[model samples]
Target: MKADLKQIQSPIKSEMAEFELRFKDLMKSRVKLLDHIMNYIVRRKGKQMRPMFVFLSAGVCGDINDSTYRGAALIELLHTATLVHDDVVDDANYRRGFFSVNALWKNKIAVLVGDFLLSRGLLLSIDNDDFHLLKIVSNAVKEMAEGELLQIAKARKLDITEEVYYKIIRQKTASLMASCCSVGASSTASSPEIIEKMREFGEKVGMAFQIKDDLFDYGEEEIGKPVGIDIKEKKMTLPLIFALQKADWLEKRKIIHLIRNKSENKKAVNEVISFVKQSGGLEYAKEVMNRFYDEAMTILQDFPDSEYKESLSSLVTYSIQRKK
Candidate 1:
């Protein structure tokens, strides 16, 4: 599941280059801890998908200005901050094939670094003086926190409804993506109507991204994490939710028993996995994700044709189809 940056279509490659440099520059502060954290994240190497959107939206709308760099860096900082906090919350050992911040350092350090990054994001956005951008991003942060809490509440509740699962994903994952697109459009002075359309595109694509991620928990061959990570963690994701809905009473009871037992070993988890496969939920979830991806592409078509539009479509395609 490697994403090739060269494959991304570019109408304004020169501007994007400048935007990338500016983003890197913005991330480069003199503080030792902050510098180290930023360097680690940069070396880990994300797709920079949100930053791409920022630059692309600005270019598609018109020119690359200071707002473009501010928006791009702010989104990157927000995303990196979230990743650090998520690693601590998940107690994760690995991320992007490297040790997570929480794995290398203590949780307290990771939390502090995450806080710094998030505060930096807010400050940079405020410096830009776009009250609307600040409001949108602030709301996204709040929603993400609420979503985490909702997932925590639903944990181990085998009866967690698909609607609740969707709500969690919408708040935790889609909201940030929505903010990314909205900020991109707003940074370029795009009309409110245009920003709304872009936000819709990001939200739909983000939902597809999250659903596909859930699907991978069952499909990924490598088992560094548990085979059924979400299940073991007592988190009910879409595939399991769908399986419970469509399963017969007997099968449903078996799932409920396994979930309730809480001490189910490798063999028991494997059996549950087989049950989910037999119930056709995995394929159903994949189909649903594909449908969302297709719909997102349809929305991209509504925007006038451009290389940025093409990359945005390609990004959604890659996100849903990716294995990791």
Candidate 2:
């Protein structure tokens, strides 16, 4: 049976609860308008996956302490800032079924809000003298920006190779998770080697997490996003990239033409999905995702058995196996 998030969070339930209160306090602002917007953002938060990674990794490495909570909050504040900015850049109206910050407040205010959140995160670390944790997360934020720019540059041409895909996802999705684990370990005063190991483990889990997200574009039984959204947006995911690789020149050109020109048409989108499915793209992607999942599990085996270790292991499984 698949373990749900509630069960996986059992080891760190109290820490997570305390982190929530601390996080809310960190987000508080003296400005009334900013305070109101921050509250709105807090109310619409999704599942607290990043913080779980932080707290769990800290527990595995050593004891969870004040620094661990600060580390988790730092990740959340920085990540939320990115999401707010992303909505503005994408001109998206909704995020996770709620109105985006930009949608309600408009672009100008939204941009400032993102900046505010970023500063708050920085100050939170600086005030606590958690420079080590700060360094880990700040590098991740930089990599994330670089990764987004790389994806945008590549998306225009739609010629991303498998290796390029790995690079993009590693920086775009995996880097933040890597920082979360590293920060967790660092907050516990773990040695440099152990921190690096947790970072690698987090990176592998993140890679698997992203591939699983890409698979949902093929219309899995339970999907969080609408099917064919990636194709419509002309984003070349692993399955589509692999399928195109297997096709003859003429067939490849035809699908590319369809995606470039007629993606708005439901029929064209369906054709592309059908092509990927028939070409064994889904199976290949699943195989790759499972490989990363296994690698992450192997890394987890380095740590001793404990509730924290078990929950961390379960969290890795839940990430790739989640229906969403």
Candidate 3:
């Protein structure tokens, strides 16, 4: 069953509200044009799941403080900047079912805004002497860029293995989540051992989260895009990768031809989805996601019981079961 986001967040509702204010204040700009764009971004913000992770992690480990708010600000700042740049790179007009920054402001302005946001995030850390926090976020940014480039490099051939797919998502998606947990622990002055454990826990949950998102490509629900958009984009997701591994040479070639040569074809996309479903690829992916979820839960078990700990567990459930 899917976990309710509102319920999962109830534990930190007040802290999240404070974090929202801090996030907005951090994005404030002297230039009117930049301020307008920042306002738009704030209005259209999604769940703010990253900040929620930070606050919850802090609450579980120690207590929320000024440092916790700063950590949340840094994560959201970098995360938003990346999304804007990603829209320009992917030529995507929509994000979270709304117009992307690139679509509304043009690529030049969008790119500049992204750069400004990134610089602000870095400066926020440096100015406050949060060098340790800077190191964690800087590494996540580096990993995300490498992960994206790797995926694009392999897109032409559509030749990603299960191991390679894990590596890509770890860098592209899990790195940020890991940062959230690490930053949260650090903000509360948790020991190095505890911080490492939280980081690993966040990484595992993030891995499961991405796989769950991949599963939605084959789901019947109408998410922001048409079904099998990943197929249309020739992206190699877990189910398709597993299906290919199980197919004979001739069948494998046929499937690859559809993905590589006829991905735009509605019939081909439907056929590929059907093939993956029939091959038990979806089931296999779900099992993998569950394994990660369970591992994350085990890590949390080492922490003492508290309302915050239960909420963090609920977050793990929410990550895998979220429809969007």
Query: By TM-score, who's the top model here?
Result: 2
lDDT of 1 by residue, 42-109 (tens): 77866677777666666555556777677777777887888899999889988987999889878999
Each model's lDDT comes to 0.78, 0.95, 0.91
Give per-residue CA lDDT, model 2, range 1-324, as digits (tens). Answer: 689999999999989999999999988999999999999999999999999999999999999999999999999999999999999999999999999999999999999999999999999999989999999999999999999999889988989999999999999999999999999999999999999999999999999999999999998856578999999988889999999999999999999999989989999999999999999999999999999999999999999999999999988988887887
lDDT, candidate 3, 203-252, per-residue tens: 99889988888888997456635689999998999999999999999999
- Which residue pairs overlap in candidate 3's backbone? none
| RMSD after Cα superposition, model 2 | 0.8
Name model 3 segments beyond 4 Å from true: 1-3, 220-225
- List per-candidate RMSD values in Å: 2.5, 0.8, 1.2
The alpha-carbon deviation from the true structure for residue 159 of candidate 3, after best TM-score superposition, in angstroms, is 1.6
Better of 1 and 3 by TM-score: 3
Model 1 per-residue lDDT at 281: 79
What are the models' TM-scores? 0.91, 0.99, 0.97
